[model samples]
Target: MDVMVPRVAALPAAMELLDRLHDQHGPLMMHQSGGCCDGSSPMCYPQGEFIVGDREVLLGVLDLRLFTGQVRPDAPEDADGVPVWISAQQFDAWQHTQLVLDVVPGRGAGFSLEGPEGVRFLTRSRVFNESEVRALAQQPVLTGADWDTGARPPAATRPQVVTDVADACAIPGG
Candidate 1:
Protein backbone atom coordinates (compact mmCIF):
# COMPACT_ATOMS: atom_id res chain seq x y z
CA MET A 1 0.00 0.00 0.00
CA ASP A 2 1.27 3.46 -0.87
CA VAL A 3 1.25 6.15 1.80
CA MET A 4 -0.08 9.53 0.82
CA VAL A 5 2.26 12.50 1.10
CA PRO A 6 1.34 14.90 3.86
CA ARG A 7 0.47 18.32 2.45
CA VAL A 8 1.43 20.19 5.63
CA ALA A 9 3.85 19.92 8.54
CA ALA A 10 5.31 22.08 11.35
CA LEU A 11 8.67 22.94 12.83
CA PRO A 12 9.66 22.59 16.48
CA ALA A 13 9.29 26.30 17.08
CA ALA A 14 5.80 26.21 15.69
CA MET A 15 4.93 23.19 17.78
CA GLU A 16 6.17 24.93 20.94
CA LEU A 17 4.15 28.03 20.19
CA LEU A 18 1.15 25.91 19.36
CA ASP A 19 1.53 24.04 22.61
CA ARG A 20 1.47 27.31 24.51
CA LEU A 21 -1.45 28.54 22.46
CA HIS A 22 -3.31 25.29 22.96
CA ASP A 23 -2.85 25.50 26.68
CA GLN A 24 -4.10 29.05 26.78
CA HIS A 25 -6.76 28.91 24.12
CA GLY A 26 -7.63 25.24 23.78
CA PRO A 27 -7.73 23.12 20.60
CA LEU A 28 -6.40 25.10 17.66
CA MET A 29 -6.94 25.52 13.94
CA MET A 30 -4.68 27.04 11.32
CA HIS A 31 -5.51 28.71 8.04
CA GLN A 32 -3.23 30.00 5.33
CA SER A 33 -3.90 33.68 5.01
CA GLY A 34 -5.29 34.52 1.60
CA GLY A 35 -4.01 38.08 1.58
CA CYS A 36 -5.18 39.17 4.96
CA CYS A 37 -3.40 42.05 6.74
CA ASP A 38 -0.49 39.74 7.49
CA GLY A 39 -0.09 38.85 3.84
CA SER A 40 0.32 35.04 3.59
CA SER A 41 1.28 34.03 7.07
CA PRO A 42 -0.43 31.03 8.58
CA MET A 43 -3.06 32.26 11.02
CA CYS A 44 -3.86 30.31 14.13
CA TYR A 45 -7.16 30.36 15.94
CA PRO A 46 -8.97 28.53 18.66
CA GLN A 47 -10.91 25.61 17.22
CA GLY A 48 -14.69 25.94 16.72
CA GLU A 49 -14.21 29.72 16.69
CA PHE A 50 -13.51 30.12 13.00
CA ILE A 51 -16.32 28.84 10.84
CA VAL A 52 -14.59 27.53 7.76
CA GLY A 53 -16.77 27.70 4.71
CA ASP A 54 -17.17 25.68 1.51
CA ARG A 55 -14.37 27.54 -0.23
CA GLU A 56 -11.89 26.31 2.33
CA VAL A 57 -9.81 23.24 1.66
CA LEU A 58 -8.57 21.01 4.43
CA LEU A 59 -4.89 20.64 3.53
CA GLY A 60 -4.10 18.18 6.31
CA VAL A 61 -4.43 17.62 10.00
CA LEU A 62 -1.14 18.43 11.79
CA ASP A 63 -0.30 16.18 14.72
CA LEU A 64 2.04 18.36 16.82
CA ARG A 65 2.13 15.90 19.69
CA LEU A 66 5.58 14.62 18.91
CA PHE A 67 7.34 17.93 18.42
CA THR A 68 5.85 19.71 21.39
CA GLY A 69 5.86 16.65 23.63
CA GLN A 70 2.40 17.74 24.69
CA VAL A 71 -0.80 15.86 24.22
CA ARG A 72 -3.27 18.47 23.11
CA PRO A 73 -6.89 18.42 24.09
CA ASP A 74 -7.40 18.61 20.35
CA ALA A 75 -11.06 18.65 19.39
CA PRO A 76 -11.33 16.37 16.41
CA GLU A 77 -11.47 13.26 18.57
CA ASP A 78 -10.90 11.10 15.54
CA ALA A 79 -7.81 12.96 14.31
CA ASP A 80 -6.14 13.99 17.59
CA GLY A 81 -4.58 17.03 15.91
CA VAL A 82 -5.17 20.48 14.51
CA PRO A 83 -6.67 21.00 11.07
CA VAL A 84 -4.89 23.23 8.56
CA TRP A 85 -6.92 24.86 5.85
CA ILE A 86 -6.45 27.09 2.83
CA SER A 87 -8.77 28.87 0.52
CA ALA A 88 -9.61 26.73 -2.49
CA GLN A 89 -8.04 29.31 -4.76
CA GLN A 90 -4.87 29.29 -2.72
CA PHE A 91 -4.75 25.52 -2.77
CA ASP A 92 -5.07 25.52 -6.51
CA ALA A 93 -2.14 27.90 -6.78
CA TRP A 94 0.00 25.98 -4.30
CA GLN A 95 -0.96 22.42 -5.13
CA HIS A 96 2.54 21.47 -6.19
CA THR A 97 4.16 22.65 -2.97
CA GLN A 98 4.12 21.23 0.53
CA LEU A 99 3.64 23.61 3.47
CA VAL A 100 5.90 23.85 6.51
CA LEU A 101 4.48 25.74 9.44
CA ASP A 102 7.32 27.60 11.10
CA VAL A 103 7.27 30.28 13.74
CA VAL A 104 8.92 33.70 13.74
CA PRO A 105 9.31 36.27 16.48
CA GLY A 106 6.74 38.96 15.76
CA ARG A 107 3.16 39.85 16.35
CA GLY A 108 0.69 37.52 14.69
CA ALA A 109 -2.21 38.70 12.61
CA GLY A 110 -4.51 40.96 14.56
CA PHE A 111 -7.39 38.59 14.28
CA SER A 112 -5.41 35.46 14.88
CA LEU A 113 -5.30 33.99 18.37
CA GLU A 114 -1.52 34.23 18.58
CA GLY A 115 -1.35 38.00 18.23
CA PRO A 116 -0.78 38.59 21.91
CA GLU A 117 1.83 35.89 22.12
CA GLY A 118 4.44 37.95 20.18
CA VAL A 119 5.02 35.15 17.74
CA ARG A 120 3.50 34.60 14.34
CA PHE A 121 3.07 31.46 12.32
CA LEU A 122 4.95 31.34 9.05
CA THR A 123 4.48 29.19 6.00
CA ARG A 124 7.54 27.82 4.31
CA SER A 125 6.99 25.75 1.19
CA ARG A 126 8.88 23.32 -0.98
CA VAL A 127 7.98 22.04 -4.38
CA PHE A 128 7.22 18.35 -4.45
CA ASN A 129 9.41 15.94 -6.37
CA GLU A 130 7.92 13.94 -9.20
CA SER A 131 7.29 10.83 -7.12
CA GLU A 132 5.74 12.79 -4.27
CA VAL A 133 3.55 14.74 -6.68
CA ARG A 134 2.42 11.51 -8.29
CA ALA A 135 1.64 9.92 -4.95
CA LEU A 136 -0.24 12.99 -3.83
CA ALA A 137 -2.26 13.04 -7.02
CA GLN A 138 -3.87 9.79 -5.96
CA GLN A 139 -4.63 10.99 -2.44
CA PRO A 140 -8.07 12.24 -1.50
CA VAL A 141 -8.31 15.93 -0.66
CA LEU A 142 -10.80 16.89 2.01
CA THR A 143 -12.65 20.19 2.24
CA GLY A 144 -14.71 22.23 4.60
CA ALA A 145 -17.86 20.99 2.92
CA ASP A 146 -16.90 17.45 3.86
CA TRP A 147 -16.09 18.58 7.39
CA ASP A 148 -19.43 20.29 7.87
CA THR A 149 -21.03 17.01 7.01
CA GLY A 150 -19.03 15.28 9.75
CA ALA A 151 -16.63 13.54 7.38
CA ARG A 152 -13.02 12.80 8.28
CA PRO A 153 -10.15 10.94 6.79
CA PRO A 154 -9.92 7.31 7.81
CA ALA A 155 -7.87 6.55 10.92
CA ALA A 156 -4.91 5.46 8.84
CA THR A 157 -4.65 8.80 7.05
CA ARG A 158 -5.87 11.04 9.81
CA PRO A 159 -2.64 11.27 11.75
CA GLN A 160 -1.15 13.72 9.28
CA VAL A 161 2.28 14.73 10.59
CA VAL A 162 3.89 17.95 11.84
CA THR A 163 7.09 17.29 13.73
CA ASP A 164 10.59 18.61 14.12
CA VAL A 165 13.42 16.96 12.18
CA ALA A 166 15.14 15.58 15.27
CA ASP A 167 11.87 14.22 16.55
CA ALA A 168 10.50 12.84 13.29
CA CYS A 169 13.08 12.42 10.56
CA ALA A 170 11.08 9.43 9.37
CA ILE A 171 8.07 11.54 8.47
CA PRO A 172 8.89 12.81 4.99
CA GLY A 173 7.22 16.18 4.82
CA GLY A 174 7.53 16.77 8.54
Candidate 2:
Protein backbone atom coordinates (compact mmCIF):
# COMPACT_ATOMS: atom_id res chain seq x y z
CA MET A 1 0.00 0.00 0.00
CA ASP A 2 1.26 3.46 -0.90
CA VAL A 3 1.67 5.75 2.07
CA MET A 4 -0.20 9.01 1.71
CA VAL A 5 1.83 12.16 1.33
CA PRO A 6 1.25 14.73 4.05
CA ARG A 7 -0.26 18.05 3.06
CA VAL A 8 1.93 19.70 5.71
CA ALA A 9 5.55 18.96 6.58
CA ALA A 10 8.20 20.57 8.84
CA LEU A 11 11.84 21.30 8.28
CA PRO A 12 14.49 20.23 10.82
CA ALA A 13 14.85 23.58 12.50
CA ALA A 14 11.11 23.94 12.82
CA MET A 15 10.86 20.50 14.37
CA GLU A 16 13.61 21.36 16.83
CA LEU A 17 11.76 24.48 17.81
CA LEU A 18 8.62 22.41 18.25
CA ASP A 19 10.47 20.02 20.55
CA ARG A 20 11.75 22.81 22.75
CA LEU A 21 8.37 24.45 22.87
CA HIS A 22 6.64 21.15 23.60
CA ASP A 23 8.96 20.64 26.55
CA GLN A 24 8.13 24.05 27.89
CA HIS A 25 4.42 24.09 27.10
CA GLY A 26 3.48 20.42 27.42
CA PRO A 27 1.40 20.34 24.19
CA LEU A 28 1.10 22.61 21.17
CA MET A 29 -0.94 23.39 18.06
CA MET A 30 -0.23 25.47 14.98
CA HIS A 31 -2.25 27.86 12.86
CA GLN A 32 -1.13 29.20 9.50
CA SER A 33 -1.58 32.91 9.07
CA GLY A 34 -3.70 33.88 6.10
CA GLY A 35 -2.01 37.20 5.47
CA CYS A 36 -1.88 40.68 7.04
CA CYS A 37 0.87 41.44 9.60
CA ASP A 38 2.11 37.89 9.94
CA GLY A 39 2.08 37.14 6.22
CA SER A 40 1.91 33.35 5.92
CA SER A 41 3.84 32.39 9.01
CA PRO A 42 2.69 29.44 11.09
CA MET A 43 1.77 30.40 14.65
CA CYS A 44 2.29 27.85 17.42
CA TYR A 45 0.08 27.98 20.49
CA PRO A 46 -0.58 25.80 23.49
CA GLN A 47 -3.06 23.12 22.47
CA GLY A 48 -6.53 24.65 22.66
CA GLU A 49 -5.13 28.02 23.68
CA PHE A 50 -6.15 29.72 20.48
CA ILE A 51 -9.82 29.33 19.85
CA VAL A 52 -10.21 27.83 16.38
CA GLY A 53 -12.96 29.87 14.86
CA ASP A 54 -15.48 29.25 12.10
CA ARG A 55 -13.22 30.85 9.53
CA GLU A 56 -10.34 28.50 10.15
CA VAL A 57 -9.61 25.23 8.35
CA LEU A 58 -8.15 21.97 9.65
CA LEU A 59 -5.34 21.20 7.23
CA GLY A 60 -3.65 18.09 8.64
CA VAL A 61 -1.70 16.67 11.55
CA LEU A 62 2.05 16.14 11.81
CA ASP A 63 3.79 13.39 13.75
CA LEU A 64 6.38 14.85 16.14
CA ARG A 65 8.28 11.57 16.39
CA LEU A 66 8.69 11.36 12.63
CA PHE A 67 9.79 14.96 12.38
CA THR A 68 11.64 15.35 15.67
CA GLY A 69 13.58 12.07 15.58
CA GLN A 70 12.47 11.11 19.09
CA VAL A 71 10.60 8.30 20.75
CA ARG A 72 8.85 8.39 24.11
CA PRO A 73 7.89 5.25 26.02
CA ASP A 74 4.84 6.95 27.50
CA ALA A 75 3.57 8.35 24.19
CA PRO A 76 0.14 7.18 23.19
CA GLU A 77 -0.73 6.20 19.61
CA ASP A 78 -1.82 9.75 18.78
CA ALA A 79 0.39 11.55 21.25
CA ASP A 80 2.94 12.53 18.66
CA GLY A 81 0.42 14.00 16.26
CA VAL A 82 0.05 17.79 16.19
CA PRO A 83 -2.81 19.44 14.48
CA VAL A 84 -2.12 22.10 11.83
CA TRP A 85 -4.82 24.61 10.97
CA ILE A 86 -5.22 27.32 8.35
CA SER A 87 -7.91 29.85 7.58
CA ALA A 88 -10.46 28.53 5.11
CA GLN A 89 -9.91 31.65 3.05
CA GLN A 90 -6.22 30.88 2.93
CA PHE A 91 -6.83 27.23 2.07
CA ASP A 92 -8.83 28.46 -0.91
CA ALA A 93 -5.82 30.44 -2.04
CA TRP A 94 -3.30 27.62 -1.70
CA GLN A 95 -5.18 24.35 -2.08
CA HIS A 96 -2.74 23.11 -4.72
CA THR A 97 0.32 23.61 -2.55
CA GLN A 98 1.95 21.80 0.35
CA LEU A 99 2.82 23.85 3.44
CA VAL A 100 6.42 23.38 4.57
CA LEU A 101 7.10 24.83 8.02
CA ASP A 102 10.53 26.29 8.63
CA VAL A 103 12.15 28.41 11.32
CA VAL A 104 14.45 31.41 10.89
CA PRO A 105 16.45 33.85 13.01
CA GLY A 106 14.97 36.99 14.61
CA ARG A 107 12.01 37.47 16.89
CA GLY A 108 8.64 37.01 15.21
CA ALA A 109 6.73 40.28 15.06
CA GLY A 110 3.53 38.48 16.00
CA PHE A 111 2.30 36.49 18.98
CA SER A 112 3.31 33.05 17.71
CA LEU A 113 4.90 30.98 20.48
CA GLU A 114 8.33 31.27 18.93
CA GLY A 115 8.33 35.06 18.84
CA PRO A 116 10.22 35.27 22.09
CA GLU A 117 12.64 32.48 21.24
CA GLY A 118 14.58 34.59 18.72
CA VAL A 119 13.23 32.40 15.90
CA ARG A 120 10.03 32.64 13.90
CA PHE A 121 8.10 29.92 12.16
CA LEU A 122 7.51 30.61 8.48
CA THR A 123 6.18 28.70 5.52
CA ARG A 124 7.74 27.65 2.26
CA SER A 125 5.80 25.73 -0.36
CA ARG A 126 5.75 24.24 -3.83
CA VAL A 127 2.85 23.41 -6.05
CA PHE A 128 1.83 19.79 -5.92
CA ASN A 129 2.68 17.71 -8.96
CA GLU A 130 -0.09 16.07 -10.95
CA SER A 131 0.30 12.76 -9.11
CA GLU A 132 0.22 14.47 -5.71
CA VAL A 133 -2.85 16.39 -6.71
CA ARG A 134 -4.54 13.15 -7.70
CA ALA A 135 -3.73 11.56 -4.38
CA LEU A 136 -4.92 14.64 -2.51
CA ALA A 137 -8.17 14.53 -4.38
CA GLN A 138 -8.92 11.17 -2.85
CA GLN A 139 -8.41 12.50 0.69
CA PRO A 140 -10.99 14.43 2.62
CA VAL A 141 -10.61 18.12 3.52
CA LEU A 142 -12.47 19.83 6.38
CA THR A 143 -13.54 23.46 6.18
CA GLY A 144 -14.42 25.62 9.17
CA ALA A 145 -17.75 26.61 7.78
CA ASP A 146 -18.86 23.00 7.58
CA TRP A 147 -17.53 22.51 11.10
CA ASP A 148 -20.20 24.91 12.35
CA THR A 149 -19.94 26.30 15.90
CA GLY A 150 -16.28 25.37 15.79
CA ALA A 151 -16.99 21.78 16.72
CA ARG A 152 -14.34 19.25 15.79
CA PRO A 153 -15.20 15.97 14.13
CA PRO A 154 -15.91 13.45 16.87
CA ALA A 155 -12.92 11.25 17.62
CA ALA A 156 -14.78 7.95 17.28
CA THR A 157 -16.65 8.98 14.12
CA ARG A 158 -15.54 9.22 10.53
CA PRO A 159 -14.66 12.68 9.29
CA GLN A 160 -17.68 14.66 8.19
CA VAL A 161 -17.81 15.67 4.56
CA VAL A 162 -18.84 19.29 4.08
CA THR A 163 -19.16 19.06 0.33
CA ASP A 164 -17.73 17.30 -2.67
CA VAL A 165 -14.59 18.77 -4.18
CA ALA A 166 -15.43 17.01 -7.47
CA ASP A 167 -15.97 20.31 -9.26
CA ALA A 168 -12.43 21.49 -9.69
CA CYS A 169 -11.57 22.47 -6.08
CA ALA A 170 -14.38 24.81 -5.31
CA ILE A 171 -14.53 25.37 -1.53
CA PRO A 172 -17.81 24.22 0.00
CA GLY A 173 -18.97 27.65 1.10
CA GLY A 174 -16.87 29.75 -1.22
Candidate 3:
Protein backbone atom coordinates (compact mmCIF):
# COMPACT_ATOMS: atom_id res chain seq x y z
CA MET A 1 0.00 0.00 0.00
CA ASP A 2 2.15 2.83 -1.26
CA VAL A 3 1.11 6.46 -1.30
CA MET A 4 0.34 7.29 -4.91
CA VAL A 5 2.97 9.71 -6.14
CA PRO A 6 1.89 12.69 -8.20
CA ARG A 7 3.57 13.31 -11.53
CA VAL A 8 3.54 17.06 -10.93
CA ALA A 9 3.30 19.22 -7.85
CA ALA A 10 3.85 22.90 -7.04
CA LEU A 11 5.96 24.33 -4.28
CA PRO A 12 4.13 26.37 -1.66
CA ALA A 13 5.60 29.56 -3.07
CA ALA A 14 4.51 28.59 -6.54
CA MET A 15 1.06 27.78 -5.21
CA GLU A 16 0.93 31.23 -3.68
CA LEU A 17 1.66 32.74 -7.06
CA LEU A 18 -0.96 30.54 -8.64
CA ASP A 19 -3.44 31.85 -6.09
CA ARG A 20 -2.59 35.42 -7.01
CA LEU A 21 -2.98 34.64 -10.70
CA HIS A 22 -6.27 32.87 -10.11
CA ASP A 23 -7.57 35.88 -8.29
CA GLN A 24 -6.65 38.15 -11.20
CA HIS A 25 -7.66 35.77 -13.94
CA GLY A 26 -9.89 32.75 -13.25
CA PRO A 27 -9.62 28.98 -13.41
CA LEU A 28 -6.13 28.18 -14.63
CA MET A 29 -4.18 25.52 -16.52
CA MET A 30 -0.48 24.97 -17.25
CA HIS A 31 1.57 23.70 -20.15
CA GLN A 32 5.21 22.58 -20.25
CA SER A 33 7.30 24.58 -22.70
CA GLY A 34 10.00 22.57 -24.48
CA GLY A 35 11.20 24.73 -27.36
CA CYS A 36 13.16 27.93 -27.80
CA CYS A 37 13.07 30.74 -25.22
CA ASP A 38 11.61 29.04 -22.17
CA GLY A 39 13.77 25.94 -22.26
CA SER A 40 11.35 23.68 -20.34
CA SER A 41 9.55 26.27 -18.31
CA PRO A 42 5.92 25.89 -17.34
CA MET A 43 3.34 28.19 -18.91
CA CYS A 44 0.11 29.10 -17.20
CA TYR A 45 -3.17 29.96 -18.91
CA PRO A 46 -6.76 30.55 -18.06
CA GLN A 47 -8.56 27.26 -18.14
CA GLY A 48 -9.91 26.50 -21.63
CA GLU A 49 -7.82 29.30 -23.06
CA PHE A 50 -5.09 26.97 -24.32
CA ILE A 51 -6.03 24.40 -26.90
CA VAL A 52 -4.81 20.91 -26.04
CA GLY A 53 -4.00 18.75 -29.00
CA ASP A 54 -3.03 15.07 -29.40
CA ARG A 55 0.53 15.72 -28.42
CA GLU A 56 -0.30 17.06 -24.99
CA VAL A 57 -0.24 15.00 -21.81
CA LEU A 58 -2.22 15.86 -18.70
CA LEU A 59 0.32 15.63 -15.88
CA GLY A 60 -2.46 15.75 -13.31
CA VAL A 61 -4.19 18.30 -11.14
CA LEU A 62 -2.13 20.64 -8.94
CA ASP A 63 -4.24 20.51 -5.81
CA LEU A 64 -2.75 22.18 -2.77
CA ARG A 65 -2.09 18.73 -1.35
CA LEU A 66 -0.25 17.18 -4.29
CA PHE A 67 3.14 18.37 -3.10
CA THR A 68 2.66 16.32 0.03
CA GLY A 69 2.00 13.28 -2.12
CA GLN A 70 -1.33 12.65 -0.46
CA VAL A 71 -4.81 14.07 -0.78
CA ARG A 72 -5.71 15.42 2.64
CA PRO A 73 -8.95 14.12 4.06
CA ASP A 74 -9.66 17.62 5.33
CA ALA A 75 -9.01 19.25 1.98
CA PRO A 76 -11.65 21.59 0.60
CA GLU A 77 -14.53 19.59 -0.82
CA ASP A 78 -14.70 21.81 -3.89
CA ALA A 79 -11.02 21.50 -4.65
CA ASP A 80 -10.92 21.33 -8.41
CA GLY A 81 -7.20 21.40 -8.87
CA VAL A 82 -5.38 23.41 -11.48
CA PRO A 83 -4.52 21.06 -14.31
CA VAL A 84 -0.89 20.76 -15.46
CA TRP A 85 0.26 19.56 -18.84
CA ILE A 86 3.41 18.49 -20.65
CA SER A 87 3.96 17.66 -24.28
CA ALA A 88 3.48 13.96 -24.91
CA GLN A 89 7.11 13.75 -25.95
CA GLN A 90 8.15 15.65 -22.87
CA PHE A 91 6.23 13.28 -20.70
CA ASP A 92 8.16 10.39 -22.12
CA ALA A 93 11.46 11.97 -21.21
CA TRP A 94 10.24 13.08 -17.81
CA GLN A 95 8.15 10.08 -16.80
CA HIS A 96 10.96 8.65 -14.75
CA THR A 97 11.03 11.68 -12.46
CA GLN A 98 8.64 13.91 -10.56
CA LEU A 99 7.91 17.32 -12.08
CA VAL A 100 8.02 20.08 -9.53
CA LEU A 101 6.60 23.51 -10.41
CA ASP A 102 8.32 26.47 -8.84
CA VAL A 103 8.41 30.23 -9.17
CA VAL A 104 11.38 32.56 -9.40
CA PRO A 105 12.14 36.28 -9.66
CA GLY A 106 11.85 37.17 -13.35
CA ARG A 107 9.40 37.61 -16.19
CA GLY A 108 7.63 34.54 -17.51
CA ALA A 109 8.75 33.34 -20.93
CA GLY A 110 5.54 33.69 -22.92
CA PHE A 111 1.83 34.16 -22.31
CA SER A 112 1.70 32.26 -19.02
CA LEU A 113 -0.71 33.85 -16.59
CA GLU A 114 2.03 34.83 -14.13
CA GLY A 115 4.19 36.79 -16.59
CA PRO A 116 3.25 40.24 -15.41
CA GLU A 117 3.67 39.44 -11.75
CA GLY A 118 7.47 39.94 -11.88
CA VAL A 119 7.89 36.22 -11.17
CA ARG A 120 8.29 33.44 -13.69
CA PHE A 121 7.12 29.86 -13.39
CA LEU A 122 9.81 27.24 -13.79
CA THR A 123 10.08 23.47 -13.47
CA ARG A 124 12.52 21.73 -11.14
CA SER A 125 12.60 17.98 -11.17
CA ARG A 126 13.66 15.05 -8.99
CA VAL A 127 14.27 11.57 -10.17
CA PHE A 128 11.64 9.34 -8.65
CA ASN A 129 12.67 6.43 -6.48
CA GLU A 130 11.78 3.00 -7.80
CA SER A 131 8.78 2.89 -5.52
CA GLU A 132 7.61 6.37 -6.45
CA VAL A 133 8.09 5.64 -10.11
CA ARG A 134 6.02 2.50 -9.73
CA ALA A 135 3.30 4.45 -8.03
CA LEU A 136 3.22 7.06 -10.77
CA ALA A 137 3.20 4.48 -13.53
CA GLN A 138 0.31 2.71 -11.91
CA GLN A 139 -1.83 5.82 -11.93
CA PRO A 140 -4.01 6.82 -14.86
CA VAL A 141 -2.20 9.32 -17.05
CA LEU A 142 -4.63 11.34 -19.18
CA THR A 143 -3.78 12.08 -22.78
CA GLY A 144 -5.31 15.46 -23.59
CA ALA A 145 -5.67 15.10 -27.33
CA ASP A 146 -7.57 11.86 -27.06
CA TRP A 147 -10.81 13.57 -26.15
CA ASP A 148 -9.88 16.89 -24.61
CA THR A 149 -11.80 19.84 -26.03
CA GLY A 150 -9.96 22.48 -24.04
CA ALA A 151 -11.63 21.00 -20.97
CA ARG A 152 -10.32 18.91 -18.09
CA PRO A 153 -10.72 15.18 -18.18
CA PRO A 154 -12.55 12.39 -16.17
CA ALA A 155 -15.44 14.80 -15.57
CA ALA A 156 -15.71 17.51 -18.24
CA THR A 157 -14.77 15.54 -21.34
CA ARG A 158 -14.83 11.79 -21.93
CA PRO A 159 -12.99 9.95 -19.19
CA GLN A 160 -9.44 9.15 -20.17
CA VAL A 161 -8.44 5.57 -20.85
CA VAL A 162 -7.07 3.94 -17.73
CA THR A 163 -6.14 0.60 -19.23
CA ASP A 164 -3.06 1.97 -20.86
CA VAL A 165 -1.31 1.65 -17.52
CA ALA A 166 -0.01 -1.65 -18.79
CA ASP A 167 2.53 0.18 -20.94
CA ALA A 168 6.27 0.25 -20.33
CA CYS A 169 5.75 2.88 -17.64
CA ALA A 170 2.61 3.60 -15.61
CA ILE A 171 1.06 6.95 -16.51
CA PRO A 172 -1.65 5.49 -18.75
CA GLY A 173 -2.52 7.67 -21.74
CA GLY A 174 -0.32 8.43 -24.72
**Cα miss at 104, model 3 (Å)?**
0.6
State TM-scores per candidate.
Answer: 0.82, 0.76, 0.74
Model 2 CA deviation exceeding 4 Å by range = 69-76, 144-174
Give the Cα lDDT of each candidate.
0.76, 0.70, 0.68
Q: How displaced is residue 33 in candidate 2, in Å?
A: 0.9
Ranking by lDDT: 1, 2, 3
Q: Best by lDDT, which number?
A: 1
lDDT of 2 at 158: 18
lDDT of 3 by residue, 1-174 (tens): 345566766666777777667657766788888778778789999888888777788877765333333343554522436788888888888888767777789896678888778989877765777878677667667787654554443432211112221221334353
Q: How accurate is candidate 2 locally (lDDT)?
A: 0.70
TM-score of 1: 0.82
Off by over 4 Å in 3: 64-79, 146-174
How do the candidates rank by TM-score, highest first?
1, 2, 3
Q: Report the Cα lDDT for residue 106, model 2.
A: 88
Off by over 4 Å in 1: 68-79, 155-174
Better of 1 and 2 by lDDT: 1
